[model samples]
Target: MSDFIKRARAAEQAMRSVFPATPLQRNVLLSERYDADIWLKREDLSPVRSYKIRGAFNAMRKQDGQDLFVCASAGNHAQGVAFMCKHMGVKGVIFMPVTTPQQKIQKTRMFGGDHVEIHLTGDYFDDCLGAAQDWSAEKGGYFLSPFDDMDVIEGQASIAVEIEAELGVPDHVILPVGGGGMSAGVTTWFGDRTHCLFSEPAGGACLRAALAAGHPTTLDHVDTFVDGAAVGRIGQKPFDLLRDRHLSDVLVLSEDRICATILELLNVEGIVLEPAGALAVEAVGEVQSFIRGKTVVCVTSGGNFDFERLPEVKERAQRYSGVKKYFILRLPQRPGALKEFLGILGPDDDIARFEYMKKSARNFGSVLIGIETSKPENFVRLFAHLDDAGFTYTDITNDETLAQFVI
Candidate 1:
């Protein structure tokens, strides 16, 4: 066995003292859908509701003389470090962006209890990260990187060790890429034996950028919807390990489409997967033809979803599936005009939203309308009827800038 694999096994053994191995269960629903033996590595079931705890545990345990641990994160990494600090009986100072959701902040405090101190700093994660590094350097505290550290990378490899022990090696392993610690470790441990696939949110596909540039390249913009995996740039250490891998191995999934997968898993399978957690499972659609009869494993990376976001998730899912749309309509300021517009909708269509303003001197009024239908094809029919009736409208469902202001 390679030395890396041996260390990973050791880390896995050490973790038994804390939390049990997460389940590796065959998903009959997914298996039937893909016509393949599909399994989910339930990392979402980990103590902190993420695989992040594994790296935090391993890294903290290896620091024999270290008493102070510091880290900056707006999500899972903060909770992971806080949990470990409480478990290891060490002092931890965690830095988080000031704009982080109250749910996440409360959870981190709950996990750390009195063992950890949380400092809300800056508006963005990078701002807090810089403050954390500066504090660590000044106070001589050991700074814990979310993914860039070698010890953390090795700690993350424990996931692969547990997987191999449960079912040996599968034909394919789908991993979600953020900072790349977990993917790097798992891929390294599995090595050439498994066809490893990396999944990234299309808005923050840092791994894809790195592969194209032949080095880690920071993205100009990032959509923070997939908070767990929306990294602006892949970690330098992770890129070093993943650089040799083919670009085709990386899959970029649309943010809106991922919401549909999240809703499907929630409604059909009763699985509450965060956007990042659902990436690997969503990727199955892209590779269904290739793994028809093979054994496949998808790592459900995290389940730290906030219930308040459910409405937005449903909205995005409906829009992506074409069952929902928003539009601005020009309605004549005359009697029966509103009634005439309503007549354009089909039997299966329902008005989800409607707002109108009639200018005193204008001949026409502007109407903002949102429509929901039973099927995606129903929209085509609805549009056809609108066109035939001579009603002027603009589809604003896919207009990012306009939707942000109106929707």
Candidate 2:
């Protein structure tokens, strides 16, 4: 066995002092769907509801005499560090963005109890990070990076050690890529023994961008829907470990599609997964051909989801599945105009929204319409009927800016 694997095994054994290894259970639903022996490494079931606690605990344990630790995070990492600080009886100062939800702040407080102090500083994570770094430096406190630190990477490798200890190395392992710490650690430990696949949210595919550019690169814009994994740049240390990985091994899934997967897991399997947690399981469909008949494992990274986002999740999923759409129609000013438009609808189609915009000419008015249907094919027929009737309409379901402002 290599030195890294040995260290990972040691880390895994040491982690039992804090919490037991997370479950690795065969998922019958996914196995049947993909024709593979599918298993889920349930990091979502951790005390912090994320694999982040592994890295946090490992990094903090090695600090020995360091009683003061500082870190910045708006989500899972904050909770992980807070939990560990409480467990280690160390003082921790955590900085988070001002816009962070109350539920998350409460959870971090609950985890840390009296051992951690949370400072809600700026509106963005970068701002909070800078403040945390400066504050930690001034106080002679050790700064705990969420992913870039070597100890944290090795800590994350404990996940791989746990899997290997139980299943003796599956044929393939699919991991969700955020700053790439967990994926890098797992890949380093597995090396040539297992085929590894990385899944990332399309809005923040830092790993894919880094692989393409031959180095870590910053993104101009990132959608924060997948808040846990939406990193602007891959961590320097993580990129170094993942530098040799091919672009083909990375799958960038759309945010909308990920929402669909989140809903599917919740509705079908009774699994409540955050957006990042669903990435690996969602990628299974993208590589079904290669993983077929093989033993495959997907790391479900976190379940720190708020039920308040359910409506938005459902809307995004419906839009991606083509079962829902919003459009603006040019309606004639005649008395029967609305009735004539309704006559073109299919039996399965339902009107979710109908409103007449005030911006209208004497002869014509702009009508905003939202439609929900049983199948994607329903839109084809519905649109065909609209065309036949000489109705002018603009589909705004995919119009990002316009939909954001109006829908």
| TM-score of model 2 vs. true structure | 0.97
List, residue by residue over 1-407, the lDDT tens digit for candidate 2: 37777777778889899898999999999999999999999999999999999889989989999999999886888999999998889999999888676667889999999999999997666668789999999999999988888888999999998899899999999999988899999999999899999999998899999999999998887777887887788889999988998889999999999999999999999999999999999999999988889999999999989888999999999999999999999999889988989999999999999988965788999989999999999999999999999999999999999998889
Residues 1-407, candidate 1, lDDT per residue (tens digit)?
38888888898899999999999989999999999999999998999999999899999999998999999886789999999999989999999888776777899999999999999998666678889999999999999999998778888888888888889999999999998999999999998999999999998899999999999998988788887887888889988889999999999999999999999999998998999999999999899999999999999999888888999999999999999999999888889989998888899999999988455347887888999999999999999999999888999999999999989
TM-score quality measure for candidate 1: 0.97
lDDT for each of the candidates? 0.91, 0.91
RMSD of each: 1.4, 1.4
Model 2 scores worst on lDDT over the 10 consecutive residues at 1-10
Q: Candidate 1: what lDDT?
A: 0.91
TM-score of each prediction = 0.97, 0.97
